[model samples]
Target: METTFVGRHVEIAQVARLMRESRLVTLTGLGGVGKSRLAHRVVEESVAEFPDGLWLVELACLTDPHLLPETVADVMGLADQPARRRAEVLAEWLGPRRSLLVLDTCEHLVEAVASLVDTLLRAAPRLRVLVTGRQPLGAPGEHVYSVPPLPVEDAVALLRERAGLAAPPDGSGGEGGAAELAELCQGLDRIPLAIELAAVQLRTLPPTVLLRRLNDRYHLLTGDGGPVRHGSLRAAMGWSHELCTPAERLLWARLSVFASGFDLEAAEYVCAGGPLPAGQVLEALTGLADKSLLQREEHPTGVRLRMLDTVREFGAEWLSRLGEDSAVRGRHRDHYLRLARRCATEWPGRQVEWYGRIRAERRNLRKVFELCLADPQWSRAGLDLAGTLWFLWVCCGMSREGRHHLETALRADPGPGPERLRALWVCAWVAALQGDLAAARERLDQCRAEDPEGSVTGHVLQVEGMLALLRRDHARAVELLEEAMAWHMAKGGVLSGLLPCHALAALGLLAAGRPAEAVETLSEGQALCEVHGEEWSRAQMEYVFAWAGHVEGEASGALRHARSALASALGFEDLSLSAACVEMIAWAVTEEGDAGGGAWLLGVAQAVRDSLGLPRSGSGIFAPVREQTLTQAVKVLGGAGFDTLFAEGQGSDLGIAVKYALGEKIS
Candidate 1:
């Protein structure tokens, strides 16, 4: 567990000096050449110079560039506000603070990180950034530092340190041992990661034997006198890979299917089959980790293994060469598909836990989606996968990405089936959330054409009802939702549409000026969810229940329901529903004669919407209510008092806003 940085003092000092002189310092080098390690050393030495302290944002697990700003803000402990762009908020927060922001692994998201860094440097005069990647950010006035591999002496020293500890004391340390270690480092091109990997082998192999096997592997792999850095690194990897038992090599290649780190169970599930039986996966995985092909780390849930991108690429190449790439990819896709289905199925009863699991595997799901859509044969499966993840996309605020993948899969595979029908309806839901009613309608029409009498008819009807509600056709919306609910109740299958049907029906009834009926409908939905142990749609039903109570002059009851809804929505990260709950709480408070509190809550709702990148449309079920609340609040609090309260709400944290909505006094 004690990992010591070896032989980078001069590089670290030089980088530290460069950072002090430059606003942005980018440490660029080949993979496994120790760029990340050097950056860590430099930051460790230089962090005390900044008053605000140093912050490291690891980008290796981030797959979506669109989330870069939000990710950074989250790391900086910024609350999600719906009223402003995350990037603008982040810049404002960092503007007066003197700190160093270290962005690790920017190569995959170079453009996003560069753009963000550019904006931050312009807005935050006192802020500096340090980036580690295979390439430079190439920003204005940026300083690029190329990290070279360790010199022979330092490489030997690192090897000796690791080897000395790992090797038996009596079996190590002689002039011959030193010579063999030096030759091994030379063969590995002095790359610190490669050297360390080779050093660990000394635990099992003597220096002489290790060097001989490495030489044999290098002779078999090297050709054409390639660049020393590239050839040596590749040869070292090949040697290490060759050292693995056949089962271990198979697992190593299969592990490349994962886009991020995974635990043992996941590896066993996805990579175990044929030559590598499920029973042997753990042993093979441990073997690979022992040889440093897989990096193991402890997580809150369990120990996870990760392959460096470079090593993964090598394994992937071998996988393709062995012609098992497609087979392994199929298994990978199947495993994640099962995972998504499980999350969706369990989300109702275990909302928070399922949400976290889905979030953790989001990258792998993306890879599954990509692989499925890229092949015509698997296009239907891709559509099914995308449709199944509708909850994660719509309720979890991944509307944009959900739309992208859905649209791609839809375009690629227009073949008619139950999967396509489901995808069409899911696509419509995403479109409706984005305010593209035309697109939503078009997709619904396509679903209807595909199978008006099929199982997806209920979902299609629910989507139509949603569109009707958004367009203010409340009566028609209610009728459609009721019909969908009845159809789903009769069907009673695994893909039953009960949740969406009930939730939308309640909203439709509420929108039609029938609060009493809406309350009854929501109660029915709540009872159904409770019977089934589902919570996903219950949050939205709770919001509508709050509005129903508010309409019926039950202010205290409305406040209770609103708070409950907000808590559930926040638990699931359902931003839109949370904002609606806030608005409902504001309405109730205003009705109770607390106009100042109501105005502030209203402002918080606006901020939440702004942070989520949702536009304020003049039409909707709550638009008139919102207008009335704002007018009443302003009239009671007066213009000056209202502005002050609104400003306070705008700057308040989301948690504070929630507490205020629940009638807690602010400190």
Candidate 2:
């Protein structure tokens, strides 16, 4: 192997040592400090010792907080496992195999990463995880190696390499020129990022003249150090900013309003205010990309753009300095508000093709919420945003952020009226989803106290009933669902629409213990989904079908239904449905008396959970059947070990099983 590390021998050795001694090694450092570069080098050098191949999962492109694990699973080439249900599979696959899993750039998804690493470490005794990020993964036995910048001489040497220049002559400069240049580079931290940037200018500008220009205190010198701040690479980002064109700088400042990566339309909408023209957004974006400031990637949705944390920080600082924060935030807020309204309007029909599209835009929605909350005047706008996202938040399990924004909006003093009712109902619904049963009941009571027969009260009942079903309060669930349906029907309400149908299906299935009947009822809701084109309905209906098939002892059929459900699950990026689907598949495979297949499916499901960074319930329709099937399968597959069976790849292939069970080719 060509060991081409310019000057990171000490860090590399430390990482290698950590890898040998510890189960987890985390290389935490600022961006551009070569943390990723160093980790890659170490893995390449040491990976030959492991039986399993080294796996690298780069999380820089990950924007959705909930899908971090799923992304990892995807990178590992395991697509059959449903959302948040792959951890066990990952652990099972790695448990007996000696392997190194390298997770790169994990700051944005810290919690999920922590949970996943924790699970994998516990399950796989020999597997080692190497993570490079701004912060540590914070797991036990975690060996954190902080990567510092290169030493001055080494940094200058590397810069020269990148700049394609020979070493400067000793005393070639008169007076303090060499010292001045070195001092400038030192202030920039002798970081590889800063030195390389300064080296670039060396093609045209002499080190002395560049040093002189850098001496001016006001203008940012090209030489800036890379420092890991807030567990993110923010400091090195400054140097990249100092090298931007005026137009690019302007665009960079405005683009900070985005919470996650965005498409071109978003750039035109938010970054196009003031001097930056809509036409120039793409030009500026391309400029940034060329400079290695912004990352451009092709997503399933579209070509999306992203920035490093440090770079985004610098952009935000510039935005603040230019006093464009408020105006740009307004545009961001306005853009998402319009988007929410559009999604809400179309949510009732077949325009539902855009459900996943809208789900993907949730980061922008969060940014809008922040903007709205910051300016009291925009609280009404915040109300609209939160109210519109009620279904997504409650039904889709974004209750964490949804409830947060709802409370913030409620406290912001938006005037009392029907809109207030909407916000109140959302708060109640969020509380219920969060399992704050007391708070949910209190909020519902408050809404009813205000107007017992109001539209908001109906929503409260819907959530109450849904919560009841979640807690297995089947009788209470039925009562609440019935009351909600009656209230809505009496009001002839079509606005808080899907809740009634969802409540109906949930109560019917749970009470009747008839998954097939529940599927039929939920299918009625699908017509509404077809009319509205909302994907949540599709996901909900899939849940019903999967559960029903599992209950009816049709494991093969259940797996088929679960696979079909995944499109809608992927559409909404909903982890719950993904988990449900995977659980069902695992159960179904085991039920077919295929121990090897069940084990493989279990491992696949665990992989999904690991990728999702969470646990799942196996009590539902598919879960119980899956457990029973797996119990029998595990006995049959346990010769030397289950891991051996997994390694042997002896499971009945999913393709064969699908054909035998569903009478159709699996997508």
Q: In lDDT terms, which candidate is top?
A: 1
Root-mean-square deviation of each candidate, in angstroms?
4.6, 7.4
TM-score of candidate 2 versus the correct structure, residues matched by position: 0.69
Residues 1-667 of candidate 1: C-alpha lDDT, one tens digit per residue:
3378788878988898898899999999988899888888888888678876478887876777866876676566443333225576577666666889999989999999999999988998999999999898889989999999898878887887876643335444663355667787887889987787776666667767876776666666665454444766776677677678999988888998789888777898889989999999999998988777878887544577898877887888779878999888888888888888887777656767777767777678878887887788888889999888887777776676678778888898988787788788888988887677899999988888889567677788888888898888989999998888888887883223777677778877777788778778788888887887766677777777777776777888888888888888877677777778888888888988899888888888876666555555333866766787888898998899988998777666677788777667879
Per-residue C-alpha lDDT of model 2 across residues 1-667, encoded as one tens digit per residue: 1224687777778888888988898888766677888888898789687766578987765555555555565456444232224576677656666778899989888888988998888898878899988898787888888888887767766756655665556833533345555665675577666565566556566666655655452234222443324221232354356567878999999888787788898889888856777888899899887766677877667788887655676788789989888788888878888878876776665334555667677556766776677778777888878888776675554555566667778788547666667888778876754446677777677667666457566677787777777666666776777677677767765446553456344535655565555665667666655664555666667666666676677776677777787656655555545655655666676676666656665654544444333334342223454466556766877645667654344233333443333335555
Candidate 1: where is the Cα deviation over 4 Å? 1-24, 40-103, 108-130, 137-141, 150-189, 205-217, 224-229, 297-303, 342-348, 452-455, 493-496, 586-604, 616-619, 624-645, 652-667
> With candidate 2 superimposed using the best TM-score fit, by how many Å does residue 85's alpha carbon deviate from the native?
18
TM-score of every candidate: 0.83, 0.69
Candidate 1 Cα deviation (angstroms), residue 475:
3.0
